[model samples]
Target: MSKQLPDLTPIGVVAIAALCTTSLLVGVRSLGALQRWELLVFDWMIRLRPDDPPDPRLLVVGITEDDLSRFGWPLSDRTLAQALNQLQQHDPAAIGLDLYRNLSQPPGYEELVAELNAPNLIGIENDNVDPPPTLPEARIGFNDLVSDPDGPIRRNLMTFEIEGKTRYSFSLRLALHYLQLKGLAPEVSPTGAIVWGKAVFEPLTSTSGGYATIDAKGYQILLNYRAEDRAVETVTLSQVLDRQVPPEWIEDKIIAIGTIAPSIGDVHYTPYSSTSSHPFMAGVVIHAQMLSQLLSAVIDGRPLFWFWSEGVEIAWILAWTVGGAAIAWWCRHPLLLVAVSAGGIGVLVLTTWGIFLAAGWIPFVTPVLGWAIAGSGVVAYRAYQSGRQQQIVMKLLGQSTSPEVADALWSSRDHLLKNGKLPGQKLVATMLFTDLKDFSTISEQMPPEALLEWLNEYLEMLTEVVQEHHGIINKFTGDGIMAAFGVPIARQQPEEIAEDAYNAVSCGLTMSDRLQILNREWQQRGLPVIQMRVGIYTGPIVAGSLGGKERLEYGMIGDSVNIASRLESCEKDRQSSICRVLIARETLTLIREQFVVEHWGPLALKGKHQMVDVYRVLARQQKTGEVPVEPPVDFPQPKR
Candidate 1:
């Protein structure tokens, strides 16, 4: 009976693969390479977002090269005052001047200062620059953009502390001004998050999403770009000053005015602005995007970018690791493993990208790397284990079995072998014992070298006959050989056991015939001629690999094995042919009708208390017509 293959590799490989792959990925992630890849993936997803219509609540008044050419760089204070006055004439909800004005120009300096004092006008500043001196601290907001180490701006700094005073960002101030009319003011939630109306602006941590360690000093959040390119209605400074901009474009909307000329160098890289078509965004436009994000979240219920906690993210990575390992363990074929692994990765990528589209930022590259590495590790381990088992099985059988049997053994190795060793099993099998008739006398007559060579020749010929009959040469006993049939894999049906018995007898007869040829050859070469004795028995016996890892062999252990050995030496003086074969009743009973045998009445074997009926197998019963042989039933069968 064949045992089913255990689920050891499939089940155990997952744990091993996940543990090893996760450890490796986590360690490498600490080195920062994984975070870079994750950021790149984030950028790609952002770029793939569908284009959004321009925000109706905001407008950008850019100072273009054409405007710079028309009015010269850093337009005069009077020109800035004229533009601010024109925007105010439209009754805009709020206007952000994204330019430094710490020092005033001579002409219309009072006019610019008066405009800066307007309740709806907010002036920008940062640690490196100061706001217009005319604007009070309440009307000033910082414009600090936080860029990742790789040169792309992915985060927004909403607020910062300067001299023990908390200040809002320019974008946040504009958004708050717009929301103030709705009676929704920014308040701190119990969890220390900023809650403005319906949206909770969760602050980022040093290990948020894919960031290993970040300078998350100020209140920061992941920036979710509204579009791949500009998504706000825009007009140049000259267009506004020339009054080409319609009044409705600025009315009741947040307006931002800043330099957009490449030579002005106010441009910064964003997810959308990384391509050749739109490589960088004006600082003013980025602030506009941030304002749009905040207002839309509080008023329109648009979600801000959210991330799983570190624990959740770690669990997510482990899940994919197990997924990859499971795939590799189940798929033994190379092509199938690759195809399934690719499909697994595809699913992971789609899942993460979908979440990102919904404003959820999660790790992508770490999970992907963990998945691929775990699967590959399992595949390599399985391959190594298979090779090792094959070697052990081949060694156990002494490489003396037929190719068909050897292949069958290996294919069923997962069942027949365990932990690189074959466990002992009771099976109904045939044991054949062979020895030179007078080996000690023959060695005395010839030199040691000649004797060894002659003995090897006889054993080699007998080994071939044994293999041809589907039997395994278990071990060499110096001048003798021990072989087994219906072993490694136990025979379930009586017919299979009977067949094993018949084949053992047939192999003995074939060996006897080949010996005659060898005798003639040896006589011509002046070598000693020889005769041999073969004992065959079939019954229940224990079969398994015996000995430690250093030296192992297939062992047959049972009284049946001992009986077979005794038969070969019992009544040794009664030789009647070149090879005398003796069989116990247990073996003759199974093959009595196929082979002609002479019954040797009950006799005691060397190590047994019970008497046994032995027989001498002379030849096969040649028949002219088809004859049906009834299956043996009285023979001692192995327990199920």
Candidate 2:
């Protein structure tokens, strides 16, 4: 058995490709780049979100710069009281005084406390301070905003239990207060989730998008900011205090109060705000966003932001890993594979965002990186693989074939090394046997070194012709050569086997013609001319590696090979010709019209039980063209 081309590249390529793909997927969920990309894709989705007109039921009343300039920095308690008294007359549903009045900023302290005691005035309190601010417990809520690590608010803390007291957020309390007047009070479900009217807010945990471990300390949920336009109907504190505000703007409206002064207002970042020249929204407006989302979820049936189950996300990552590996394996060319991978990434992003725009939270980063890792990694492995295979082929063929031919074989190794390794297989091939005529007589007349040099010249010429015809020279015996075709690489179709047959006969005839020209050159150089007889037999044969583990040679072993060798001896045909080429009838059937053949009839060969029909190949039929190579200047063309 001959040495097989070991499977080096394919298995390693698959393993490394899989490893790289998996690493990319894991990195996407764990690495910071993936998190940033997820955020960017999210921002794009937010930017593309359709805008809605401001809700008519809710109103935003803020202390604008004009109001601040009029009311003097921190408005005195009397000014706050005067604004409150004016709002009371309008019969608004609820009033959220977003400013913290834990310490009195007073010109009229007694009057401000009296106005603060009103049932609709919701005061803000801060828990971050050492001595937490005090408020009328019934009308107070914590004014705390939960920001992501990027310092932008995307989640809402509806209600948190602190020191056994269930404290609500500034927005949730304000919204509840407004809903209560309309006979829709906030209720807690048996599951401990807040249900505003009919909408149950699903809370966000640490596992929410890209949040591996977050502080989920409260009744937190994703905050979907109001659409692009100014969603809140607004009026300033000065307008309300000066009695310049229309009654209808405050009447029956859920009014939220905050300062819009860029200098003094509590500002925070939000999604919709990113599109503005000044992206920071007032703390009160952020709270208003929370309230609007809640009310809209209940009344308008708006969908809440949601994340995929952990199992589903893992499966998605795994799916992309496999997809990347498959694409890498199928496309081995580096540049072409990269282009394909780029196209794949583009499609993934477009499809992911398309689903996101439709309210589906599909991931984009993990999958695409998996594709690049698999694709580029596979391309690298195959390039290494090609170099290794080329080395092996060069090592095996030795100095018999040219570097160009070896490179050509390396480039097309996928055809030769099927499924990574070549296994022993039965195939149909042509075996050509060539022996120098009168070699014993010629060799005895020359010195040992001269005869050896003489043999090499003939061998080189024959080997080159065999390679040109895509045949493998197996071995040299004394002064004869044995070559086989369609070995190691099996032919899948019958037409391929016939082509192998054609190549064998063409190579034998070319060697004969080249030898006659070589004879003229030898005659001029005062060297003895030589003649060689060729025999070709085509049939079903077993062609593969042959020998022990240390020494190996690929060759064919069958009756066809034996028959071709026997015919090349010239003694079996009972002919006296100097050098003639004979082909078996089995081979003749495949190339009957392509050569000028003489029927030599059935003749029993050495070591064969029965007689087999043979034909002498006189000459090859020229192709249908006028130009012949060299124009036969010295030798006349042989006639049919």
Candidate 3:
């Protein structure tokens, strides 16, 4: 009959879900800014260079210190012509010169121009207002730099407007050139960005004029770099000029040459940037990434497209919120609850990261925060509630009962206080009423000090007997004690009530014997000894907490109680009145096998409509150091 613990998970979950939803909305509204920051972090973390075998289609021909030392610094056009002529012998698939040829060089400038007119050559171009016209056949595309608002090279300018006409640039332009070389003219949208066939581009909504917002979904770029040198065949300008390396090293290879010197300030700080800056690597590496991307597009048919990761965020948030709440509510052990919550968070984080890597989607962060917050809140609340419940139990049962009974009472208070009615439940009970038989006479014989001390000692011993049998003492009248069994709570069986009565009888007999020794000692001292009479009855009765608000006590008031009190008074009528214990017929019937009893014929009892039969217990049968008392027989035959 203990109080039921309240469940708090559902409430906690609802609160967390609400917080998550709100956080999600806020995140979405700032999607563009979040995406930009995410990109910044990603760009800082992801290594652009390949850790294994290099992609076969991309090559970097470095303009190294070795090349410079071999050919002399800022070599004349004649020397450049010699280098170009040697490069032409290799017949590269495409050649991108990272240096601009806007001004004339030296004697072989025209021959260098003739070499630039080759079909697969691309040149770098600065964002100048005007420039001299160049041969269309040699200039496959232009390379232009695009930076962020803070002037960091974070975006690739695929196309830009010049003189009110859109012109393509950078790696995208090179990809277009490659496509044209393969006889596949890439479809161009009206906006001048190349239309990737069958690839859907859902641009994120933006409020900044016609400028498209860069959400986490809207940009998808890949890179390829080989860890091993010469993974993609490369012939330096010195090698080409000296014919030291094979001509086929560059033949049909997509050759990219650029500065890699740290002093020249040509190196870009990519996510993979390291201390070793071989002067010509920055532009060459970017070109390599672009080339690999283009080859992957053709061979693997992997299209880059935007996916809204918002749904994933919302789903994960709800999952953790519910899961955390469940753990907090269902787990009784504090450690287990904490372990479950932590394990849930770990699983969520791993799942989110895995899905992001596999499907390119980002989950919302607020859901995770919500789950943590809700779980902590629930645990704290549960602890507080548990403490409060314990305090209420202590307040109610602490003082009035024996420690053991108080604990039992507190635990079963729910059942005891059901419907707030007195004598709340039916129970098979034994009622015991004990009166100080000659207490007034003893008090008159003894000094007041001695009388009070003796009474307290007697009552203390008597109360112990009742409590030991799991019986509650209802109250103590001036010179008497009333105790009830199977009450305040109920016993499972009627036999237990009989057992309680027997125990009380045994305790009374022991007390009477012990008092004889005390009386002998007191007689020597010229003081009176006290005597008591006890009555027992067992029957069904209503038992529960009773009394008004401030004076509540667990008690039973019924006909059985009245009969037991009457039986106690009847003790004086017996021939052998020295033994002062009497039991009613009802109690005797339930314990016939236990206690041996002599019958007392039916006697008129006050406040009762009928005469009641009773019995006087004689002795108990002994077995294995324990005495077994049988129930009393029917009242003795009336004398003729």
TM-scores, each model vs. reference: 0.88, 0.82, 0.62
Model 1 has an lDDT value of 0.85
Candidate 1 vs 3: which has more TM-score: 1
Q: Give the TM-score ranking, best first.
A: 1, 2, 3
- Compute the lDDT of residue 137 as modeled in candidate 2: 72
For residues 1-640, could you state the per-residue lDDT of candidate 3 as single tens digits?
5663543345654565446544653465354444444444334333332354566655666666676776665656677667667777877777776665676677778878787777777776666622214646235345544433333344444454557765655465566666666765556577634456443323332321111253222222333233323334555667657778666567776667665444445655443443334312355565566565555555455454233454554555566666665577667677887787778778876765554444243433444555665566666666665565445444433333466666776566544443333336877778888887656666777788877777776677667666665666777877778877655567776566667666666655555555556656766876655556778887777765566534555557678888888888874645343346778787777667665677877888777889888777665645666655443222222222
Q: Report the C-alpha displacement of residue 574, candidate 1, in angstroms.
A: 4.2
* Candidate closest to the true structure, highest lDDT: 1
204 Cα displacement, candidate 2 (Å)? 1.7
Provide the lDDT at 178 for model 3: 65
Q: Write the per-residue lDDT of candidate 2 for residues 1-640, one digit (tens) a residue.
A: 5455345455566666766677656665754556656665676677787776787777787888888777797888788878888888998888888876766676887887877777887877777532113346777888889987667787898888879988888887777777777687767789877677667777777766656556888789888777654767777887787788899988887778888778895888776565778788888778888888878877777777777877787677667766676677777666877777778777787878777665566666676777667666666666666766565454445445444445655666677654333335687888889987667788888999988987888888888888888887777777878887765466789787888888888888788778877777777977778767888888878865455335445557788889988888745434434347789889888886887788889988889999989888766766788454442223332221
What's the best-to-worst order under lDDT? 1, 2, 3
lDDT of 1 by residue, 470-586 (tens): 998988889889998888788999999999999999999888889888988998999877778899889899988789876787788998899889998888877768888899889
Task: Tell me the whole-model lDDT of each prediction, alpha carbons only.
Answer: 0.85, 0.73, 0.58
Predicted structure 2, TM vs. truth: 0.82
Better of 1 and 2 by lDDT: 1
- TM-score, model 1 to reference: 0.88
